[model samples]
Target: MSIFHGLSAFPLTPADAAGRVDTGALSRLVQRLVEARVGSVGLLGSTGTYAYLSRTERRRAVEAAAECTGGRTPLVVGVGALRTDAAQLLARDAEAAGADGLLLAPVSYTPLTEDEVFAHVAAVAGATGLPLCLYNNPATTHFTMTDALVARLAALPRVAAVKNPAPPSDEAARHAALRALVPADFAIGYSGDWRAGAALLAGGQAWYSVIGGLLPEPSLALTHAALAGETAQVAALEARFAPLWALFQEWSSLRVTHAAARILGLCDTALPLPIQPLPPSLHPRIEAALDALA
Candidate 1:
């Protein structure tokens, strides 16, 4: 069975003020997440700011994470790039760096046909020996993986799981239908802090989480409750995370989460250019919100 089963923490890339990836800081961050005992660690994910970094930086980030984890935990590296060849190359690199699995999204410049999407994933799957997770994040990628395509990819060798962002409306039913459509063994994980509980409650088996990266213990508590079908406990955990989720709602989670990490003294709060840093005014609110998690 694949170890890609539970809460996979998506950590932020700790970069220096000049936007250079701080490998030492990143190593420590991965160690912290590993020590927190999250089910898996996702490096160079969306939260890791994969798109912002150069190829060499991304490679170093993956290597650092794998080196730090050192087989203690599953390291799922994101190999998402706009071009198929680049994605394939990253997949190969992640596999070589000892990553446990690959997470790929259909990132594109123009509108992509379903065939193009399928081909892109297929090429990456062929490139790596590691298991692959199809990241269906339409909001960011602007390319949606329809059910037909998902079923087809599920049949591909090395394609093991999917990270789906739960829809805002009819979440339970939507996830339930998705679950029924895919193969029985194919894992359908959910992200989107607001919809995680609903996705888990609706039979989704995994959560590719951003908040969980910073707060692993609490995130695991919520995941464990969902798996045991403990509805009340799940609700309670969601309520606990509401403050952080609310901050995510107001500003982007990328901003608030990095700010929260800074507040907790996790790392330097320097995000890459083009993506602005969290405003100073929201620091107190973010600090207070993070305090609530404690």
Candidate 2:
């Protein structure tokens, strides 16, 4: 089975003043990713504000990403929803919209049994012929998939990879356990913090990245360096990115990232309501961080 590899961007879903999806900005973002030579672009994931977007908005974002990407690289659309039926619908819509694969996360409303999670994955996998990448982000969602659960789900024919956002230490162990459970064909992707390059060096096949959406060139370069076993280059890049990572450790990490993107002229800092912009007081600090890295 063909598995996705290399740097995959978790792009932000650009929205208008009324909070509607902005295809024009989204198209520009996708074009930037292609220019930067990222391996793939992921739409409607956490960085894309998937939870804040409506079903219609999600579909539009996926279609726009596919249209903009124009097969320059693979596209993965996040198909996570609070309801299983809705997730399946989104998965089908994503496939119709030309997504190469779907990143599915467990339901968030209630904690699901292992059997329920298995059934959900099976249902989405069965709903569309597209490859599936399981998204495990326990920080936002209440439930976390156990190693055994991942092993069981890895047996499904449609399941191709796992996008793990657990902390670095846990991610290492999870990768080891999951690798033991599944065949070598099944890929393990990394997310969370500045540990992605390290994880990739540790045998992760892909890096699912939020930072890539903001600074695709640097992120892709770092990924290439890590994959090439150039530790010096990787360390140098990580050192430059340390300031940004420090900001992410703050309470308003997403807001800071979004705001920093706008400052860099990448996209607007406009986020969906309930996720207000970062405090004005921190603008200088964010600008300095961006400038140092730039």
Candidate 3:
């Protein structure tokens, strides 16, 4: 699906203190991305606190986002779970809820081997007709998907794309290495907001963006400039994003993004417990960062 090939904005899934998804808020957030004209709405991804939510709440989120998108934009719902059966059920749930595609991470409690992960991903891809994107988030998942492993998974039915961490250096070389391994049409994208612009300029087909969810126009600007190979414009736009990028690296994009959302009047819901909101002391810095973007 083309859903995996552009700016896939991952929005925060707002919920009440009781962990019940605030469907109204969730719908509003999804609609924002659609109005921004993003490639897709990436609902229930890590930024959405999918791991912290119960399956029921996740299903509710997909339902709300699907209703809001209403085919106006593509919806790529994250169906990552610790158990194979649960992931399969989530995939089925997303399809039933009107999602256009699925993003599956190698979510695990035990350290999984390459063979184990291959089987896990294959199972989920086989479970649904929707195109599946492999989520290679080693920092959170604790499983690094080697290039060879990605090549193996690409051949599986319904495996359409991948969202890897943005390269820290040599974006072209890194992107080229992976491109050589996968099929010509396989969509290759990156996350890690700070480094993503370079990845895009280096021929990354997509950006699985956290900031794009909160600040779409500028993100789209950067995406457009980079896609068009406008190096000078890309550098200028990326500079304004520098301060926020620094904060994202220091405080984590999850906390910083939730803070930005509140500041922008997007949502007032807190990050699900154990993952507290950013400290009050950091609010000034966040303000200054948002000011920089403005």
What 10-residue stretch in candidate 1 is worst by lDDT?
A: 166-175
Best by TM-score: 3
Alpha carbon lDDT of each predicted model: 0.86, 0.83, 0.92
| Global Cα RMSD, each model | 1.2, 1.7, 1.0
Top candidate by lDDT = 3
Candidate 1 vs candidate 3, lDDT winner: 3
- Please give the ranking of all candidate structures by TM-score, highest first, separated by commas: 3, 1, 2
Sequence-dependent TM-score of model 1: 0.97
Encode model 2's per-residue lDDT on 242-274: one tens digit a residue. 888888878445677788878777787489887
Model 2's lDDT to the true fold?
0.83
TM-score of each: 0.97, 0.95, 0.98
The alpha-carbon root-mean-square deviation between model 3 and the true structure, to one decimal in Å, is: 1.0
Q: What are the clash counts of all predictions, listed in order?
A: 0, 0, 0
> What is the alpha-carbon lDDT for the whole of candidate 3?
0.92
- Candidate 3 residue runs with Cα over 4 Å from true position: none
lDDT of 1: 0.86
